[model samples]
Structure formats: C-alpha cells, structure tokens
Target: MAYQLPALPYDYTALEPAISKTTLEFHHDKHHASYVSKYNAAVEGTDFDKMAIEDVIKSIAGDPSKSGLFNNAAQAWNHSFYWNSMKPGGGGMPTGALASKLNADFGSYDKFVEAFKAAGGGQFGSGWAWLVVDGGTLKVTKTGNAENPLHLGQTPLLTMDVWEHAYYLDYQNKRPDYIAEFLGKLVNWDFAAANFAAA
Candidate 1:
C-alpha cells in the first residue's frame, strides 16, 4: 500500500512559541511529505512497491544497492513516529507503570530527562534519538541520517527528530537548544506511556 502522512493531533500552531506553526507545516507537509513521495518514486515499478514501508526499510538496510530506498523509507517512518510523539497538552511527568519503569531503569524522572537530553544533543549531524524497547529492556539510542530503532529489532516507545529541518525554523543553528525545548515543552509523556503499554 502507498504511504500517507499522519494527521497532527493539533493545529499547526498548537505547539506554538516552542515549535512554530510555520515549522510544523513545513516539517510535516513539506519535509515529511517529500520523503514519502521520494520513497514511493524510488520503489515505483519495483517488486518492493507493494511492501510496507517498514518491510522496505528492513530489506534496504541489508542491501547496499538499495541504500537510497532505505534512507527515504526510514525517514518516512521516523518522521511519522516523531509527529505522534507529541500532543496538545503534553510534556510533564510520566504516569503509572511507564513512570515506574522509567524510575526503575533511570533512577528518577530527572535522570530520564538528563539521559534523553544527552541522547538528543549528542546525536551528531542529521538523525534521531529514540526511547526504545530492546531485549525486554528500555534504552536510549541515536541514529544517523534517518536511521531509527526500526533499523534493528527494537520497538520504539518515543522519538525526537534531530534533523535540521525539524528545528531550523525555530531554533536555527541551535540544535541542542531545540532538543531542550522539545523535551521540556513539547514531549508527550502520555504518548510514550501508551507506546510502552503496547510494547
């Protein structure tokens, strides 16, 4: 099946001041849309065209000749996950089992914040940071150039897009600042919890 852009939970301006409407529109409609289109184009008239984007990423990742397809497909999946990693009333303390697990794993909520921030900030150049369920354990990881937890066998519970397109409008060259704002202001803990439950 062909890929589609997922709807934002709020208006473009919903993330305002912290993340601008202009940024959302361009990031979602332009940047993400472009990735989907490019991936579709790259796979057109091929046997892989009918495969799910996830499946395509898996195959492309292992095949050197399909690197371009992998980039677009992974970017498509990563951006979609990134968009849902937020909500209208988001970013506060996590709740319930998710919070409990976070504490057990990271020592405290503050520590989770510290580690998450470090993962995002430490992500070199264009990439993403993820909270992933790997081997029945929660861990933090960063991927370069559209790579995500899906590249491996892990399940992603939360993600932050560290690509310049994600923060350029609001944060400019300050990628670390943008990441700090996203964690402090826009992250959706409930969304993370839901993903955790699913895992």
Candidate 2:
C-alpha cells in the first residue's frame, strides 16, 4: 500500500506549552506530509510501489542507488512512530513490565532518563535518539538522518526526533530544553509499554 501521513494522535494544541499547535501544524501537516509525498513519488512505478513502508525502508537502506527512497520512506515511518510516542499528559516514570525492564536494563528510571537525554543531546546533527530492544535488552541509541533501529536489526520501543525542525519553532537552539520537556512532560509510557510488549 502507498504510504500516507498518519494523523496525529492528539489535537495540535494538546502538547500545549511544551509544543505549540503551530509547531505540530508545520511538523505534521507540512514536514511529514512532504516525506510521504516524496516517498510515493520516488517509488511510483517501481517494484516498491506496493510494498509496506517498513519493507521499502529495509529494502533500500544502505543502497546508494535508492537513497532518496530510503530517506523519504524512513522519515515517513519515523514521523508516524514519533507522533504516537507522546500524548496530552504523557510523561513521567513508566509502570508495570516496562518499568521493571527499564530498571533491570538501566539500573533505575533516573538512570534511564539520564541516558535517554544524553543520547538525544549528544546526537551531532539531524537525527533521532531511540530506546530500542537489542538482543532482548533495552538499549539507548542514536541514528544520523533518517536512519533508525530497524536498519540495525533492533526494535525501536520509543524515539525522540532530534532534528532541528522538530523543535526549532518552540525551543530554537535549545535542543536540550526540548529533550528535557519531552521526557518530563510529553513521553507516553503506555505507548512505550505497548511497543516493548510487542518487541
């Protein structure tokens, strides 16, 4: 099926003081929409036209001949997942199995936050910081550009977009502030739990 821009899980204004409606409008309506359009255009009339977006991304990843398709498809999938990673009043420590797993893997929730924020802030450029399942363990990782854990054989449990466009409108050059707010007030632990369970 052709890739399309997935609707935001909440209203544009729901993220409120952390993320302005204006930001969501541009990020989802324009930026993400562009990726979907470009991805469709790139794969039109090709064998990938009818493939799932994930399959398309995996098929073309690391192939210089299809970098354009890889970038667009990966961005499309990443943005979709990113939107579901948060909710209206979503941040704070996780509970249940996810909480236990995080504690077991990272030693404590505080440590997990430290590692997650560090990975996000340490990202050199346009990229993403991810919490992924690797070898049955939860690990923190970062990827440059449209790269994601899927390409590395890991399952992404949660992610934060470190790209400037993701926060420039609200946080400007203070990417760390954006990352902090996302962790402190915007992360969707339930969503993370769901992903973790699936993984």
Across 79-102, the per-residue lDDT of candidate 1 in tens digits comes to: 888888977667768889988888
RMSD of each: 1.3, 0.7
Error of 2 at 171 (Å): 0.9
Question: Weakest 10 consecutive residues, lDDT, candidate 1?
Answer: 86-95
Error of 1 at 3 (Å): 0.8
Worst 10 residues of 2 by lDDT: 1-10
User: Against the unseen true structure, what C-alpha lDDT does each candidate score?
Assistant: 0.86, 0.92
- The per-residue C-alpha lDDT of model 2 at residue 139 equals 95
Number of clashes in every candidate structure? 0, 0
Best candidate, lDDT:
2
Clashing residue pairs in candidate 1 are none
| Residue 101 lDDT, candidate 1, scale 0-100 | 89
Candidate 1 residue 45 C-alpha distance from true site, Å: 2.6
